[model samples]
Target: MIVSLHSYIAFLALAVVLLAFINALNGFLTGREFQQKRDRSISLAGVAFFHLQFLIGVIVYFVSAKGFYALSEVGIGNLSSEARLLALEHPTTNLIAVALVTIGWSRHKKASSDKAKFKSVALFYGIGLVLILSRIPWSQWV
Candidate 1:
């Protein structure tokens, strides 16, 4: 149940973050002012979804057989590349990715100008998106 929830939530989080990244990039390119209702909400939606994904992922990690159990069963050194990814790389990398997204959201609020805000979102969220994409268990996920 937890794993399924995590997986489904991950899709939502990824979509929302992608939208936010594109929106920020567009704003940066167009020199548009960040509106409180629309632009802010878009970014906030991304942050909210990513945070939810992280929480669900952590819960799943603790409970899923493929996560801590596999790590403990095989031990880190004994784990195959795929097992290591499930137990370590994906979780760790995604934690970092979420942190990057969070930082982007926080920094955007602190930015004095519109371009600065867009830049912050574009750089950090773009990087976060990349990291998230890289670590996803593509073969397993599908």
Candidate 2:
């Protein structure tokens, strides 16, 4: 049940993060004024969802036998490439990606100009999205 919830929420979180990145990119390219309500809300939603995923992931890590237990049993070197991915690479990379998104949110908040805010969100969130995409357990997810 926890894994199912985590998987479902992960999809939503990824979607929102992508939307946030695209919105920021549009704002930057068009030189549009960043509205307090819309832009801020989108960025906040992205950050919030990412944090939620991180929390869910932590829970899943402990609860799922394939997470910590697998790593402990097999040891790092003994793990097959696929097992190592789920037990280590995926979670660690996703965590870092989420951190990047959070940092982007913080930088966007502190930005004085509309362009600066847009740039901050676009660059940081974009990188985060890429990192997350690269490390996701695609086979398991499917």
Candidate 2 lDDT, 27-130, residue by residue in tens = 99999999989998998899999899889999999899889989999899999999888899989998889889989999998999999999999999999999
Weakest lDDT window of 10 consecutive positions for candidate 2 = 133-142
Stretches of candidate 1 exceeding 4 Å from the true structure: none
Q: What is candidate 2's CA lDDT for residue 95?
A: 82
lDDT of 1 by residue, 1-142 (tens): 8898888888899999999999999999999988889989999999999999999889888899889999999899999999888999999999999999999999999999999999999889999999999999999788
Worst 10 residues of 1 by lDDT: 1-10
Error of 1 at 47 (Å): 0.7
RMSD of 1: 0.7
lDDT of each: 0.93, 0.93
Q: In model 2, how large is the Cα lDDT of residue 30?
A: 100
